[model samples]
Target: MSEKWDKESILSLSGAFQTCRILLTAAELDLFTILSDGPKSVEDIARDKSWDERGLRIVMDALAATGFLQKSAEGSYSADETMLKLMAKNGSQSILPLVLHRNRMWESWSKLTEIVKTGSNPNPLGMASRTSEEVQDFIDAMHVVGSVMANRIVESLDLAPFKRMLDVGGASGTYIMAFLRKAPHMKATLFDFPRVVEMGRNRLTQHGFIDRVEIVAGDYTKDELPSGHDLVLLSAIIHSNSRDVNRMLYGKIFRSLDPGGTVLIRDYVLDESRTNPPDGAIFAVNMLCATSAGDSYTLKEIREDLETSGFVSVNLIRNGANMDQLISAEKPR
Candidate 1:
């Protein structure tokens, strides 16, 4: 069901990218952090940062116009206290990493028109193709987004029966750390690409779980999984693969699990019509812009794929309005 739309609303929707683009520009420049240090004239900022004065001034003014910054009486610009706290690099509540990742995503989305015409993302960009620094930014961004939801999702499950956990594609080990914190006696194995595993090892060491986690580095799509785990987690991972790849992955996961072990997949599981909770429908476009055949999967599609890999008792275990929907299945005993 579509919301009733008006001409004004339609026009408003068409130009929504203006504010987004302006915000992305400001965030990319680390303007929020600089302004938080102290308000400065555009000349001071541009000269210090070696940026184009004209371009910097225009974006700063646009940020003020968007109510994300304030212009002082002395002709200096600064972020509002609240906005600074959220966007500044060193602020107590900073979400800057996530913003940076979105800037990278903006680059990908810019090719949407060409992708639609070619049926492929001609100049695709993703974590698999990023520099070392950019890879850290992407991992940190995912942690910032998942830190709260991870605990909530873990709290919903009764994990007492599962002693070992395998967190597949676990970026930064955020969910694995959450699981360990919840079940102190449970040891985990985190699997991801080599670069991510190195960072994960560092974080787990800092959090004092380095001894409890066995970190494995390999690509899940074309590699064998480590076996004998009783619980597995695939959080926010499946949407990045085509169905055939997902099936191949599920089969690998199935073979890796202990008998009667449970596998939980947390993602934007769609309704039968493949469009509900609205955001999932829209996120399918994001996948299209990044992957050749990746997409948001309806529960029927997910269940069928899992079943084809020999999973049983598959069902939607949780549902939400955003990307927190979850599905669970078991390797029959």
Candidate 2:
């Protein structure tokens, strides 16, 4: 059912972007991080950063009004204690990198109208174009989000029969670590681009699970995956590819797996209509804005693609509102 909209609600909807923009702008500016040490006057902040006082004051005021920060009668703004912790750059639990990445996404999302009109991103920003800092932030963003669900998702799966596993496009080995934690005896391979492979090595080494995993560095889209695994994971990977690319990748996964081995996909598995889950519909737009040729896929599309690539017994293992949805299939024995 559609939302019951009246004039007030419609206007409210129209102004939704304003609040998000304010938050994103503040996050991008590192305003929270700046305030994390202590409250500061707008003049103090602007002078320290060589930014315009007027612009800094306005954003801080908006943040204070929105309860993200507090403004005292003395005309200084301070970040909330809890909020500051999560936005602090060096804080272990900080999600600042993810927030900053979304701040970058604002540029792409700003061109949604143009993308819709031209049926293409006017300025497609590919992964290889990212600077070292941006690449680290992107990998950190993926890890921050993946770490939350990886353990839970791994726990739900039956890992008994699977002796060896491969994590395709596994950034920093978040899911691989989780899987290994669940079943320590299983041998594993963590595959990704070379830079990301190094990050995964550090993470696994830090966690003391390095010896159990074999790290392989290669682009799944451009190279064959490492073989001899009884299970494979493609978490949040498929939505970035077009159907044709996913089909070819599925074929690679099928070959990489031992006969009757399982390949589990964790992504936004949309229904036939592709609109049942509102977030999936919205993320479809996000993919369009971010990727050169990416959009959320319906399960039917996924099943057909997998089948064409020689996967069988496709099943919707779990339905998730966000990007946590699961689809499982196998290479025939």
Candidate 3:
């Protein structure tokens, strides 16, 4: 390697959680939203939020140090440009929900040691059980993340020949909306859990797509996907399953598609080294802490699994930042 070795980098990694917790705490407190309009003194903010003034000051200073907030000469804090754009509640490109979702992950991550030792998630809820409010938050977080990449992924595809599309485990119909917006002639189906399907209904209706899309409620792992579609999208779903589980789901996807239909997978398609994207390798650890059999997979492994499930002519359509790559395969005619 050409670069010099740095012990400081490794040292910094150990304390990274401190920064994450600080940021999560701020987001949970809706600090960015509170500061969106203008700066506020610690006294003013603490009084409004009913937080201890000393603790609020420490967090605000830490946030300012992290460049998330701007500290005025008068001892007031305001949302910085980045925070205003991505953390404020009504920001144009807000990802506040995603941040909140990370906050939820904290509980699972705290049990990493036990999870690794036992090779299972310690949470009895099994990643699916959540209160109605949490379910809504998770779906909204997915929407926030999907909105950022959906258009780009849709643009990368050639959907001119396909008439109908199915998005399995599609949260809030974000990708379906993207695909439909790109190809107005295409009718689509959004399949997900019942609560997520309900959320999708509201969102699709808000986007004026409820009439064009069929919203179905079912678990992809346990239920047969809706059939008759020429295109199927398994976006951000497979990494949460083992190889056997993925193959089973792929078989289901195969049966759901018409002859010559295509199945597109949007996920972290790792290279042979499994570290080319770097993020994929790191996310594998997240899976370990959160799911029993989930992991990042190499392209070779994915191809083998797809082929075993009756798909052919598999191809990588796009490579993306942070595990958003697209891989496509076709069912034999």
Candidate 4:
């Protein structure tokens, strides 16, 4: 390592959660959206948002120091242009929903110690019993993320040879839209939960893809996947499942494919060390806090499970910026 690693670095790592909490709190308070109009003094913002002036000022200054906001000589703070575009609620490229979803995960993360001790999440209803609004937020957050990443993922693959695709657990049809936009001849079946399939219907219609895509509703864990597709996409799904669950899913995908069909998985495919992609390592902890047996996996584990499911010719397609790597395997003819 060229850079010096020391105690200060460890201290900084320990304090990193403070910055995360600050950003999450700011998103929850809609601070960036509030600042979208223009600069605002502490008193003005606190009064408008009905927050304590002193505390709001402190947080605003913290955000300014973090380069998310700019502090003016007039002692007012404003969101930076990037922040306005990406973090504001109504901005064209807004990721506010994703930030808000993280805010929802705050409570689960707080129980990390307990989860580690018990080998299970204490909150049984954390994901299962989410309120409708919470579910919408979660799904919308996935849409925001998927919309941004889908194009890159599509471009990374060669879809010309494939005619039909099944996007297992496809939420809101983000990847399906990307694929259809890239390959006009390709048709997709988006399979997700019933409620999520409803959202996908609206989104696909809005994207002018309702005619090209078939929306199916089912739980991949307990349901049979729709068959006869030449291609199957397991986008962002495996990380939330246990090894056995994933093995079972791979089998379902294998059976669902046409002869010599391909199954593509987009997830955090960690390297052998399980640390090359650092975000996947940290996200494993998120899984620990949120699910009973979810964790990031190494490529070896993935290949083994897929091969055991009777798939062959497994290979990596691309590695993503945030551990969203693409791995492809084939159901032998």
Candidate 5:
């Protein structure tokens, strides 16, 4: 049965995109830090940012309405607690990069009609004619998006006893470092394209997981995986290809996994019936725009695939927001 309408849903459904734009514009302007020091009048903020006072006031008012800032009757503003913790630069996972990338993404999405009609992705990776710089920018955007999910992903899974963990298609090692922090005994082999491995290595080290994590630079499609890892992980990685490719990769993973080892697969998973969970469904649209044969999979499909690959038992755990449910399957332990 359908649920009753609520004020929250009614407002969010209508104003969500506008709210996102308000937040993104603020992030782009570094408005949080500007206000972080203390309350700032609109005139002062506009002066510092070289923005129009009238426009700034309107924008700030929206932010206040969205709870990112608190506005006083005197027309001054201060950062809210949520903004300081998640929006400000000094926070644990500063969402700045992701916000900026969204700015670029909106531009590309204007061509969604073209992509749909021609069945071609307008993204840099999908655009064969895109310049080298454009490709780098696209990959960089992916990195920023990956960073947003890294911390929680690592914390959600346990890694204490595993000595070696292989991260297949590990983009920036954000997921690896998350795991490494908890499982101090774990050493990681981060496998991905050569350039991505290099870039992610620096990022992982920047987060202080470098000493134990080994970056493996290779195309996962053609390269040989290092054997003897206690655990293998794919974080937000496998949803990029078709079921045939996924099956091939799982087979490879089974062959490479040591006896009694585990394979942990994390991505946007659809529920058993293969519907609802709006985030995963929307992400499938992104996959359509970017990947040739990629789409989100159902948990049932994942479990069946794992079992076919020799995993004894499978467990699924769901995390909130960007870090959705994933499955852990054992290799006949």
Candidate 6:
């Protein structure tokens, strides 16, 4: 046997899976937060958290060996500096919920073989056999995912001239809150299903943006969309459904906007050739497993959709994180 193992060696797949599960389980258990204050021995840490000492010790040692923690000479363990950033509840830093949500996503992905064989979404849509709460939970999960980028999106957008921005399908008001923090002069109407609106309202209230954010409760597809906003922000939403619905939504956005208004969309966009962007390629399969018609679209595909819906000029900006692209279209005056 070779003393040094190849990083890309096929034999390491099993170890990689175990490593990911341990990291995810630690994040889900708030272990990072618990360790943020100071270092602790395995027994004390386990006793404090009511965890199994032996199991926690094994996990901690594995993480330390993997460089996520440091084992001291005194036999206590401390979180690595990079891992501490993920423990923050506020600021632009929370990765705990995002990591936990992904762990849940892994369950659906484990049945990918079944999904491919049947060509059916492993995740149930709100339509059949699923309760309203189940649907809301799915939406809330997306909300958590979206929150990760809310801070960046809010700061990046030029909201100086815009008075009221409408966040279509904006779950939990995370985007609006981030924007409100920057553009305090602007108010936002968060439009979504009634259940989502309730969740957003609760979040807005908690974030102290209740006065600046208005909740508009209704189905955006069937009902009349809230009108007269200078800007419409649809982050991580357009790629969630069929091409037809995406085009239809763009048309509605154009109509809902005042003349020369802007519509901003952020999501994983495939390259113009419909290749190269590996994240978009993988995200396409995730949509296959999750939604009835959702798949990540290419930049060319999205630009065409915007033009067909009446936007004269469309611009695409590729942000380096997670292969996400932000496209902006302006309603012709």
Clashes per prediction? 0, 0, 0, 0, 0, 0
Candidate 4 deviant stretches above 4 angstroms = 1-4, 39-49, 65-67, 70-77, 124-127, 319-321
Highest lDDT, which number? 1
Residue-level lDDT for 281 in candidate 3: 82
Per-residue lDDT tens digits of candidate 4, residues 61-139? 9998988889999999998788889999889898888888889788888899988787778774333578877878888
Candidates' TM-scores? 0.97, 0.95, 0.91, 0.89, 0.72, 0.77
* Model 1 alpha-carbon miss at residue 25, Å: 0.4
User: What's model 3's lDDT at 193?
Assistant: 89
**How high is the CA lDDT of each candidate model?**
0.91, 0.88, 0.89, 0.88, 0.75, 0.78
TM-score of 1: 0.97
Please write out the lDDT profile of model 5 over residues 176-205, one tens digit for every residue: 777777777778899887766777878877
Over 4 Å off, model 6: 1-14, 33-57, 69-93, 124-157, 181-184, 206-208, 317-324
Instruction: Report the C-alpha displacement of residue 109, candidate 4, in angstroms.
Output: 2.2
lDDT of 3 by residue, 68-183 (tens): 88899999898877778899888988888889989988877889888878877866334377888778778889898888689988888888999999999888999999999999
Taking all chains together, the TM-score of candidate 5 against the true structure is: 0.72
Q: Whose TM-score is greatest here?
A: 1
- Ranked candidates (lDDT, high to low): 1, 3, 4, 2, 6, 5
By TM-score, highest first, what's the ranking?
1, 2, 3, 4, 6, 5
Give per-residue CA lDDT, model 2, range 1-333, as digits (tens): 446999999999999989889988887888888887888999998898999988888888888888889999999888776887788786658999899899889888999998999997867666777888888999899988889799778878889898999999988989998998999789899999898889899999999989999999998789999999999999988888889899889999988999999999998877788786778889889889998888899899999999999999999998878788899998989
Q: Write the per-residue lDDT of candidate 6 for residues 137-244, one digit (tens) a residue.
A: 555566666665677666676778889899998878878888888898999999988767888898889879999888998876787678989899888787677899
Q: Which run of 10 residues does model 6 get worst, by summed lDDT?
A: 124-133
Please identify which of the two predictions, 1 or 2, would achieve the higher TM-score against the true structure: 1
Off by over 4 Å in 2: none
Clashing residue pairs, candidate 4?
none
Q: Runs in model 5 with CA error above 4 Å?
A: 1-12, 37-57, 64-67, 70-82, 101-120, 124-161, 203-208, 276-278, 303-323, 330-333
Instruction: Please identify which of the two predictions, 1 or 3, would achieve the higher lDDT against the true structure.
Output: 1
